[model samples]
Target chain A: GDQVEQSPSALSLHEGTGSALRCNFTTTMRAVQWFQQNSRGSLINLFYLASGTKENGRLKSTFNSKESYSTLHIRDAQLEDSGTYFCAAGSNTGYQNFYFGKGTSLTVIP
Target chain B: AQTIHQWPVAEIKAVGSPLSLGCTIKGKSSPNLYWYWQATGGTLQQLFYSITVGQVESVVQLNLSASRPKDDQFILSTEKLLLSHSGFYLCAWSHGLGGATGQLYFGEGSKLTVL
Candidate 1:
């Protein structure tokens, strides 16, 4: 079974619009990280959260360990924000295997 | 600031040819190193990890092996390439145990095309 399940496999938004992407975990996850992958296949780290929420510019993310889920909210989207978004979750004990979501493809149109 | 560099950028090789990809992390010490692979349009899969010199652990065996000969350098190699090995290879480093509290940083990545 997949440890993480990401939602809204694809999305499109007009410039300046807002939307959110989510991931649900099948097991207990102690931490979660959000990433944006550009067309060149480079992954840029967006957020890393053990608990609570983090806000960075037009992006905000929240990780709920108890509920086993995480979300990334994009506000005032821009053309440069077009890319694939992924969330990875990991546990605290043992070998520390981080499970990654399939990713959400976001396209911001002008 | 710490930076991760992956070499060769991209490569095209024959099916039976040997392959080696290198990653070097500058400005950080004793970092936990990891290797991840992603097929086209697929999710990232962890392949190997190393906590210290000369000790590498395999996460998923895709006919690949990794080594940590130096504190800042990690290498992924195979005796012979397989068409299935064609994908984006990423090298990452994290402080501490790379668990709940550790944040991971990734390199620019290396792309392989095995024919």
Candidate 2:
């Protein structure tokens, strides 16, 4: 069973365009973390949301814990943003508990 | 400036052979350490985590064990490998602040191939 469901397993965007990626959880989660896995296989933490929303540069993320979902918005997409984006869900119930979605592969082309 | 490092970027071993992987975190003391695995074309799954030296907990068992020998070091090992063990292994560290747990910081990840 998939605890965390990610939408748009793959996505393509034109430079300067923008879009959003989402992760829906099967149950309430304590927090959510968005990551961009680079070609080097390093997972770069983009945003960590316990609730509400956060914005960094052109990237924005929102976590609706009560709704069991989280979203990541990319604005003015750039080529450097091409990579696999992953959403990991955490819970406050247990120690080091987490759930993950496979990922959303994004590519920005000129 | 906290930095996490996973050793042996990639490795290959045969079935029945012993295996060991290591991760080290610098600039952060007593950070929660975790081991996550991703099979090729599969979703990421957490294997184990440690909150302090000499204490570790397993989230998912894949015939592997993890240990925290020092506040800054975490290790993963198995006495016998299975082909199913081949995948990408990531090491992460997390710390709580302002009464809340923070984002997980991951290393470059170690690739394993079992024949």
Candidate 3:
């Protein structure tokens, strides 16, 4: 079984719309990090949450360690937001090694 | 704050040829380093990790090997390349401390094509 699983393998949204991406962990995680892979294949870190929620610009993320799940929300989507989003969880075993999800491909059409 | 650097932004090698990729970390000492491979439209797979110099651990060996010859450098290599080895290789590092919730910083990544 996968340690981390992401939902909606692919998503499409019109400009000005909003949507959310979710990641479910099979085990307890110490922390979660969200990233967005741009067209150039460079990954940009969106959020790093030990717990609770964090927001930046039109993006927001929440990490529920007890529930073993995390969510990334995009508001008022723009074309520039189109990319593959990934969530990785670091276990509490002190290894600091992360298990990454398969990622969610998002497309914001104008 | 720390920075990670991966070399040879892109590489192309024929099957049976040798391969090597380099990564270096700056502004951090004894950081935990990792090597990851991402296939086309697939998930990122952990290949190797190192906690300190001269000690490397293989997580998912795909006929590849890694070395941490220095405190801040990690290298991934293979004696011979396979067509299936083509993909994006990422180098990452993090602060290795218990209960220290630091984000892993990744380099620009190296794209390899084993033709």
Name model 2 segments beyond 4 Å from true.
Answer: B96-100
| TM (B chain), model 1 | 0.96
lDDT of 2 by residue, B19-96 (tens): 999999999978888999999866689999988899999989899999999999999999999999999999998883
Q: Write the per-residue lDDT of candidate 3 for residues B1-102, one digit (tens) a residue.
A: 678899989999999999999999999887889999999888788899888899999999799999999999999999999998999999998877553655
- The residue pairs found clashing in candidate 1 are none
State the lDDT of candidate 1 residue by residue for B12-31, as single tens digits: 99999999999999999888
Better of 1 and 2 by TM-score: 1
DockQ of every model listed? 0.54, 0.55, 0.60
Question: What TM-scores does chain A show, candidate by candidate in order?
Answer: 0.96, 0.96, 0.96
List TM-score per model, in order: 0.97, 0.94, 0.96
Interface RMSD of each: 2.7, 3.1, 2.0
Candidate 2 retains true contacts at a fraction of 0.56
Evaluated on the second chain alone, the candidates' TM-scores are 0.96, 0.95, 0.95
lDDT of 3 by residue, A1-110 (tens): 99999998999999999999999999999899999998767889999999999999999999999999999999999999999999999885446678999999999999
lDDT of 1 by residue, A1-110 (tens): 99999989999999999999999999999889999999999999999998999999999999999999999999999999999999999885324578899999999999
Candidate 2 docking band: medium
**Chain A vs. native, model 2, TM-score:** 0.96
